[model samples]
Target: MSSTDAPRRATIADVAREAGVATSTASVVFSGKAKVAAATRDRVLSAAAELGYAGPDPRAASLRRGRSGIVAVVLEGHLRTAFLDPVTTAMMDGLTDGLADLSSGILLMRDEAGDDAAALANAPVDAVVLIGCSGRARASLEIVRARGLPVVVIEGEAGEGIPRITLDNAAASATIARHVRDLGHRDVALVTLPLDSDRERAPVTDARLAAATVDVTVERLTGTREVFPDAPAVSASGSFIDEGVRVGRLLLADPAARPTAVLAQSDLLAVGVIRAAEELGLRVPDDLSVAGFDGIAVDGISDVTLTTSVQPAVEKGRAAGEQVARMLRGERGVTQHFTCRFRAGTTTAPPANR
Candidate 1:
């Protein structure tokens, strides 16, 4: 054949012909399955190069294998929120490390408020990891379960037949509360994470308390009450620094009714409370002591380290990954609970005599 009329492109059949072998042999060589002589393999490779033929199509291979080769990591909040929280980052890093053996890749799926569960239901994933899921996350999870895919929830409540990787949120919060109480702070206020999707910033009432959908919020709130039954609780829109500042200002505004100590749900919130205290010209631990959860590093706050609870976020993710691997191996995965350590920082001290 003339060069212009040469075969438009090399097909598997062309490669087999050029290699002087059966088409099935060429297929086996590309598939990397079955034992082929090294010389035959080299011939197939050389023939494939000469014919300009790429390897077998991945879509076709996936179809043959009956697997998507993808894992979906569903995030409860916006993507930006996940990036801002160091806990989420550490957990993700651990999960990725655990999944290193898998040839497939992880796909991030954000569960937006008001979106249907169809997206997750139809996603081409063999397994799923629910990251920081709240009550709204349950609906999508149900859909995933219906599809019969193995699921692992991180820092979420355990469902019937579902394995969970949980943190000691209550114990940690109680430990912090006990520290404040031991320091002579009888009156304490709480700045909590968003209780539900509405994310309203206001005083938490009986109604809102009953409506709380996030597991972490509920457990931490319960933990605090275990120590201070009558502690006043305020709900913030999120664990953001600005939200902390706003809620902190509100709680500390009233001199007569202000709490001597404030318990924020996350370190970011604690920092915001510290800023609000500075704005009001009140000295931390002397005017008001503040404590928070999550042992994350924050900048700009010198000598005023926050007394907080530190959870093994990366290890939690690693445990979830290991559980997923177990499920993939047809073994029932065990639920793992991690404990948090109470960190005494400079942000908390005895309440000043009023």
Candidate 2:
């Protein structure tokens, strides 16, 4: 043969011929899901070794059910910016575990896929999971729905007859807000996640709340207002420490108008607020109290335990994944709800003058 001419890759047929066994028998040995004689299995294995065969390629098998074996996860911000939150990573772990039966891989797609949808449109994904089913996510959901793909929404609404994995954002936020109120914090302000798809950092205005698309942010804000009816709120661009610091400074810049306590929507945001308080020469719980949501460990704010709500983030992701799997199996998916537990910590205290 010429140097450019190469031999065809060995196949299970070649190995079966070498082992003097039927192709079906050889396949069973490779699948290992059925019983076969030890001698026969050993013969097949030895033949496979001699032929340099590495079992069957899963790529062809994965398509047998008309599934690409890839679950596309659509998230609200840029993939790089969104993964900075520990909650996303934790949820991803649970999602991976829940989809293990499918042996599927995850495809992380950003909500802003309109500008460049070549990847989203052409990618051979079996199902789509929208992290939040609002605004841009809704658009993506519509695109996939048109393609007749199974979808699961986490923490956002996708309309009627769709399985949703929701969280008690409103109730949990209300509970923590009541905790702050019980601590004699009358002058309190809220640091919120983004209100809309724009994710602009600004003061939480009435119009903005009315037009909010992100359900989690809206629910948490509504819950907090249940306790502090008139508490001022500011929106953060994202759930990062830097956004928290910026919002914290904006809320606590003037001692004359500074809120006695600040309620952040996330732990990283809370830590950022605390760091800002330190930057402004204010001691936590003494001059200013800060609390956050999510039960994840934050790196900064040394020794300061956050007063916050711990939600089952990972479980939420798992539930979404399981629901998607159910839908893929032609079964009706069920909606699941999760609640956050309030954890009182040293970061919050009664108003100093109280």
Candidate 3:
């Protein structure tokens, strides 16, 4: 056919005509909302493929249903860091699996909250899930709520009207401390997650402790204090191994002021502490004991397993996904809480004097 006389661009009406079905049937087939016979659905898909049609137009579908079929996952830091954390990875996996049945896709939105709150206010999402956010993130979250979208906060608490998916951060940390106390380690130090975006790395002082804005940091620190009221805590800029190593070296450098045990907020941090201990010629458990949270497997570290609290990362994600699904189905979604179990490993043991 001549260029001007070429066949018309395919539309849902054309697909419906080719499939010998009504436009509504064709829409249902593509949307997968209404139950259609398997054969009919297959016929609609085949017809659309033959016509080079890319199924329903998202713009048109969104207008018709008043929904975007997209859920935004608001992350607090760089995308690379979000993917590195086992906790975030596990939760994302579970959320993906849980939403698989719904055929909804996830849109990862980074909430840096610079100059303006444009991203949070303008995201084309029907709902949002806050992943590991704190401090200034709370302000962005308020914007998300103001936009009238349902929100689910994971690993952080949301005030009334927003649903929360929480882990027992305080109780779990306290449990880990109690384990250390039971091992007869009186002198202990802590390596904490970032208390704020300032990413400060220094000895956790009373002022720093009071000014902490991160919920996880606060909870874990509170838990540690339950046992070691005067435990010397140091804040790490992040949960990365390098940060852990830096904090570890600083803590172990001064033998005169070093503690017998170290409790890191993450497995990666714990591994760093172990490396630091070895660099200082301190033997594991024999001279120092270290413990961490999250049971993620670490590589290249031999003969030493981290003593940590094993939280259900994937399960937490799945639960969040299920909650999102419930909200979409016109159900009153409820908050969920999970706990971590302590895993005694080679990195921790009785104090050297024993």
Candidate 4:
């Protein structure tokens, strides 16, 4: 029991010997880089447990494999804000599930191109996933490309030669707009997500639309415009309830100028619009019709169910993760397109005046 008599620590080779398999087989069992038979995997695990082999240390494995074994998830703006959106949260959950078997870790980085460029440039990650990135964040892509890292973007455009997990933003928004128009809502207004990385909370103007750099914002706006060509629209600073409230107040303040209906780009904003309507003694649908995108649960905000187009947020994340996995395995770039389902809820109805 003396220090000199201490036993040597077990390694993958020892585990492989105990399992009657090659070291490569044992390594793949732990690394998850390749597929092995279930029975063989079970035997390997049993041997590791018997020998007190706690699998491979990630650091040592990364050194041996020349990979970081980490994936960086780049989000636009503050990390806190990204987590607040239910859609983003759902997507992250799915991404986690999709990347689970890769034996990879997730590192969240805020893509403030100018300020964090150096940090992102130096981050130790085998792959990068851009989630709902804006124009400012898109500028950081050059740095990522310079590093020769594999890239996947969810709900954002990344130009050619890059894999993108995209939604039919324009088509979905158009569906919502058409529904509102079909309800005989002639006087309608549009509330939008931030049109640029500046996150300006102001009325939508020709200058801002012309200067828009966010693809999702632009696509959704284009969809709405297709149905309500002359409708007045306001852009929210962010995709939050308070931002929606600010937009709602600005649009519904004056009864003489109030629209009969409002189409909000997000469910949270729709809830805010309803709040503004109630504050002004206007009943939803009966006095003011409201519609929202993103089929997230809006219960407890009001009794009214939100009429919206529900995109597969989790599936989008999974698709991005799958693409990243493929790239890590030396596959070429791939792209995936997802569609949304439109559900009519209690929030949208024929305007009383109509």
Q: What C-alpha lDDT do the candidate models reach, one value each? A: 0.87, 0.89, 0.86, 0.88
Candidate 3 lDDT, 114-139, residue by residue in tens: 64468778877888888865877788
TM per candidate comes to: 0.87, 0.95, 0.89, 0.87
The residue-level lDDT of candidate 2 at 126 comes to 90
Compute the lDDT for candidate 4: 0.88
Q: Write the per-residue lDDT of candidate 2 for residues 62-119, one digit (tens) a residue.
A: 8787778899998888887878999999999989888888888999998875563656
Highest-scoring model, lDDT: 2
Q: What tens-digit string does per-residue lDDT give for candidate 1 at 268-319?
A: 9999999999999999989899999999888868877889998898899888
Per-residue lDDT of candidate 4, residues 44-152 (tens digit): 9999999999977777877678988899998988997888899999998889887887889999988885558888899889999988657867867778888999999
Best by TM-score: 2
Better of 1 and 4 by lDDT: 4
Model 2, residue pairs in steric clash: none
Candidate 1 lDDT for residue 215: 85
Runs off by more than 4 Å, candidate 3: 1-9, 19-46, 53-59
Q: Which of 2 and 3 is ahead in TM-score?
A: 2
